[model samples]
Target: MQEISRVFDAERIQWASATASGHTVNSAEAYQATGVSDLLPRSPRQLVFVECDVLGLEPAEVCDHHNPGDPGYDRQPQEYLQGSSLGQVLSLLGKEPTHEQRIIAAADHCLTHAYRGECPGVDPAELADWRERSRAARFGLTHEEIQMRIRIATKALERAERIKVG
Candidate 1:
């Protein structure tokens, strides 16, 4: 555990492989044994984070849609997330947002492509392609595997002392 955690903690990124899982379609090993792949979005927070980064926007910019008091708050995504079919499912499962909420609250809005629907200065087709890719990436992963990746990432974040944000 320490060895694997060390890899995740290093400034330079490293990759490892899981022994074997019947689910993976490529490389026979989950990415660094974390079960992540180029094909998947990991989680909503990661998906939004990457999208925000690609668009030269911060998660806060995307998340402000969640905060009613913010000047730039959009309200639409928040309302939609709260009322969408996915939202109802999450509620039914009693799984309220955790990492996703913190990530959005830190930035102040919904940063997802689906949530945003259309973004200015961004090619809608490109965003749609990314969304599709994310869905595909997660295809082979089981729910448990996905959650395991999130838990490991959360642990790494908790252990981080200086994230070197610019």
Candidate 2:
């Protein structure tokens, strides 16, 4: 079991019985100093989205794992990102991804490193040599295409950052 610092006073939490999707589900309860009770989200997708939104990440950054166009698309969320601080927090909350969520993340891995040309390992000159031996396998793009995608993804990321900052 993993423990996390209390978002509120430790005394303010409890286990609450609930039902979700017609199935019995357990929920975490948080009580305010005033004695008001709140329940955390039960769905993994909603939990992840809330965390990503709170972190100011673009939807695509966290939710691009299941894109149909990715060459290596396998419908999982990017494994690497899920190991980050945000992901760790989610894990502590028992809001881990479902099988479909994992698949979505897997797809994002391809889009970020391959289609968007944002990965450090992507080398235009040696693409053919490493294409099949890499996570971005068979995701080779022409130098011009890579450059274009890099520019686009960068601009979009910049825009998202600006939005976050503002």
Candidate 3:
């Protein structure tokens, strides 16, 4: 979300997370949850539904990679299918992913073996550190702890050298 915002220079982009509740939430439900409508009067709104099915919305408005029949899923290169939502969003924005982004994509896709053997140029220690930070961020860290992890991860990524992967 931050990367996308930076790329587009968006003045404001409100965000809200909805519980899966054993199934993905519809776009309308996600929109209502944002409460952005109440904050702003009736106006044109661009709602981007990531990793969720769209309801009363066009396929182009979504960024899901789970439904095989969905355009979002069909559009991705086979190798990138594992990268999922992040890959889809980056592709949708026509952005060339950075080295850190590539690492994240690979990690998120569970390509541990590939990074360990196939991409030998990537340092295992750095990758492990990143994975630890990522897991901490996702699993129950307080807001402050998550922020600290992000800062540490960001610095580590900045210092990392880019390496080619087959």
Candidate 4:
């Protein structure tokens, strides 16, 4: 749990009972507080335009694990963004690669890292052993600082996910 907090606020999340989907989700104000919430989605509507097509599901599920809030969860947009985030990550690194590797390798790290500070020991190889260690570092930021980072990263992550590669 510390490792999760190192990158996010587990407390910031709660089961959104007012959901159309079965997976745990959030209202926008609620999500913006999480820091782990998707990104820059002023309304769920903007999510589709960014190609987060699966967002048609619901915001609540973003938090739910097996019991998912409404729809359990769909793999479409999630998989789609997995493919897309990989392409961009590789292109930026001047490489060509498979999608799964990219998601496992980078998308996750990008999701955890906050804007206000560096995530100490951010080694990709360390990720496997990281969970326990992360619990201690929880939020390298103060509360107000974390909120600011959330605002900045929301737009940034959204744009990153929305990127269209040529």
TM-score of each: 0.23, 0.20, 0.48, 0.20
> Residue 82's C-alpha lDDT in candidate 2?
46
Backbone clash pairs in model 2 (N, Cα, C under 3 Å; residues 3+ apart or in different chains), count = 15
Tens digits of lDDT, candidate 4, 61-154: 1322122231212323233222233333333334544333433333333434412123232343444334323433474645455556657988
* Candidate 1 segments whose C-alpha is farther than 4 A from its true place: 1-64, 70-72, 75-118, 141-166
Off by over 4 Å in 3: 1-47, 70-78, 81-83, 112-125, 138-166
lDDT computed for candidate 1? 0.36
Q: Would you give me the overall lDDT of model 3?
A: 0.52
Instruction: Please write out the lDDT profile of model 3 over residues 14-43, one tens digit for every residue.
Output: 543333343434654543332222232245
What RMSD does each model have against the real structure? 19.5, 16.9, 11.0, 18.4
Clashes of each: 12, 15, 0, 23
Q: What TM value does model 2 have?
A: 0.20
- Please give the lDDT score at residue 131 for candidate 1: 38
TM-score of 3: 0.48
Q: What ranking emerges by lDDT with the best candidate at the front? A: 3, 1, 2, 4
The C-alpha lDDT values of all candidates are 0.36, 0.35, 0.52, 0.34
Error in Å for residue 48 of model 4:
4.1
Per-residue lDDT, model 4, residue 56, is 32
**Local lDDT at 114 for model 4:** 16
On lDDT, the leading prediction is 3
